[model samples]
Target: MSFFYSSIVKFEIEFFGHENIRSNHQKTIEITKESHLTPQGDCIVGVNATSSCADLPLELKNKLKNSNSKIKFTISVGDDEFILEGRGHPELILAHTKDIVIRKSDFICPRTLAIKCDKASDLLPRTMVSLLQNPKTKGTFTIDID
Candidate 1:
């Protein structure tokens, strides 16, 4: 028997908000299927969540660490609001490059915004959390990646 080797690629997204309270919300993360494809394959969408202060819940974090397929997650924070981001693998990358629409809305109360790659697949939730938790992170914040 012969097996093919596939490279695992991960794409990361960053969410920027005016304040900490404007970063946490479910409507902020959105996913839509692409229109066309060249080679054609199953697209996997993974949503990762991290907080500026602490790691996501052990259960959720463990789930992401153990998954070999597409998955999404909803994370909580100690603060009022936070930013959410997502990343995926090759399948998702193909879909994204094809001009697929992955709309991520923002929180309504404080009003927040999320940005995603139009031609890339996967999102690095861990890195995003670290970035937001930098010493420069002066305000409270949270993150969700589902």
Candidate 2:
């Protein structure tokens, strides 16, 4: 007998919000079938609560060459947390500022998320937690692979 498992699979997720808030738990996202088929390509990912440039702290905001631009996050995937900056949008996290987190289902905006790592097959178009750094933090984004 033989068994096989494919990396591509549908996903359902639960996003845990701030510790004080429990009603915001169990959030979900819907994706199209097409977004799941692309293994080594880019797909649209809806990001919530992405701090605007104006929202950024004065110190972090001042370092940017363009104050008008939005701040980009260091999109890291998997346990190793490899960075996906090259494929990311023009906005950046910059050298300073490490305080960032995603939580709940705000559906801030759908941004493009590229899958171009050696472990691409292992993760793509699936449901997973992006940033739940600690017990106090419920995480920032809930990703769903179609």
C-alpha RMSD in Å of predicted model 1 compared with the true structure: 15.8
TM-score of 1: 0.21
**Number of the predicted model whose TM-score against the real structure is largest:** 2
What lDDT tens digits, residue by residue, belong to model 1 across residues 1-146?
A: 99976433223332221112211222233222222222222121212212211223443333333324333322222243323333332222121221222224211211111223222222324333344333233322222333
Deviation in Å, model 1, residue 141 alpha carbon: 14
Stretches of candidate 1 exceeding 4 Å from the true structure:
1-4, 24-69, 72-146
Clashes of each: 10, 6
Give the whole-model CA lDDT for all candidates, comma-separated: 0.27, 0.26
Cα lDDT over the full model 2? 0.26
RMSD after CA superposition, every candidate:
15.8, 16.7
Candidate 2, which segments miss by more than 4 Å at Cα? 1-46, 66-73, 76-80, 85-146
C-alpha TM-score for every candidate: 0.21, 0.25
